[model samples]
Structures are given as C-alpha cells and as structure tokens.
Target: MSKKPNIIVAEDEEYNFALIRIIFEKEGMNILWAKNGEEAIEILNKNETIDLILMDIKMPVMNGLDATRIIKKINNNIPVIALTAYALPEDRAICMDAGCDEFITKPINRADLIKTAYKWLDQ
Candidate 1:
C-alpha cells in the first residue's frame, strides 16, 4: 500500500483551499494549508514532514514564486508545483525560473490536479 504523503498547499483564496483540502482528504492524503507565502514558509521551515507542495501564485505579503525560491533553497529535494490563474507563457516561465517543478492553471480540472499530485507523490 502507498503510504500517506504530506502535502503543503499555499493558497490565499479561502474557497480554493477548502476545495483542495476536501479532495485530498477524500483521497486519504495528509495536508497542511497556508493562507499566504509567509505563512507557507513558516509552516515549511517548522515542519520537516512535507512530501510535496502546491503553491498558488498571487498572494499577499509574498507570492508563490518567491516562496518557491526560498523553499528550494531550504530543501532542494522537495518538489513544488505552481497553481495560478495566469496562463500566459511568461507566467509559466517565471514560475519555472523560480524553481517550481510544474505549473497548473487555476479553475483547475479536478482529475488533472489529482493526477499531477499523485504522480509526484509516487515519484
């Protein structure tokens, strides 16, 4: 059996975070939520158990790109996937440059989202 993986989700939107939390919970994955980049970083720095991260791009205090950069510096082995409403090529490039492993646009497709998370967790 696959062991439960710890997922760190950073989303400023309350409803979005709740939806993701419900989905992951139903799938039997453990989750940690952060309302913004700073809080996400705090959680990450304090918790050594995170297996993967789903980071939202636009947020107050700090953004996902900045957080990804910092998190990568702290733990290069952990993977971070970017989630954003920005679907532009430049946006994707920016996320890539900041050290995100993948980019998934907002208004997320449920199957795709779950698949991406599971695939990374399996790896």
Candidate 2:
C-alpha cells in the first residue's frame, strides 16, 4: 500500500471500539468507528480509501452479516473480518457466506488482531 491502511470498525459497544482504536493506532493504522452496520455502510460509501473492515456481527440498525453482503456488492475487493462473541463453527460459515474474508472471536485478542490486520494489509 502507498499509505498507512485505513480500517473501519463496525462495533456498537464503547469499550470495544476503544480497544480496537488503541490496538489499530499502535500499528499505525488509521481507524474509523461506526456505531452500527448502517453507519458502516455510510462510511464505506463516503470513503473509498478504506482498506479493511472489522465488523461486529450483532448491532442495532443493521447486523454485520447483512452489511457485509451489501458491502460486497458495492466493493468486493475490500476485505472484511467479522468479530463477534459467537464462536460457533456455523457462525464462521455464515460470515464467510455473507462476504467476510476472515473471522475472529471476541473478546478481541491483541496478537490475533495485529497479525490479521498485517496479513490482510499485505495482501
């Protein structure tokens, strides 16, 4: 990438958003926060430079899976990683089917977050 990667985090919880912001900032990634998937879609529409998305599966207004499906239609090239409390295999499969490129269970692992970000950013 020519510039530092910009990541959109679609998380409703205040603490969760803060955690992701801190972690992403430490890695020199620009971060954008969306309180729900609706806001996420708005951001995606307004900002074409976003490099990746860390999506929360459960949110008011619109859920991540639904958002991912629409987002993929708009721009399938942007990689979206689903982050949710649900660790079930079915949940992962559903996220992938919805257009998420990767899945990570919460409470977010710092190492995993950094590694996943780097892996996708490099790609």
Candidate that would win on TM-score: 2
Worst 10 residues of 1 by lDDT: 1-10
Off by over 4 Å in 1: none
Model 2 is weakest, by summed lDDT over 10 consecutive residues, at 1-10
TM-score of each: 0.96, 0.97
lDDT of 1 at 9: 94
Any residue pairs clashing in model 1, and if so which? none
Q: Rate the local accuracy (lDDT) of all candidates.
A: 0.92, 0.94
Tens digits of per-residue lDDT, candidate 2, 71-119, equal: 9999999999999999999999999999999999999999999999888
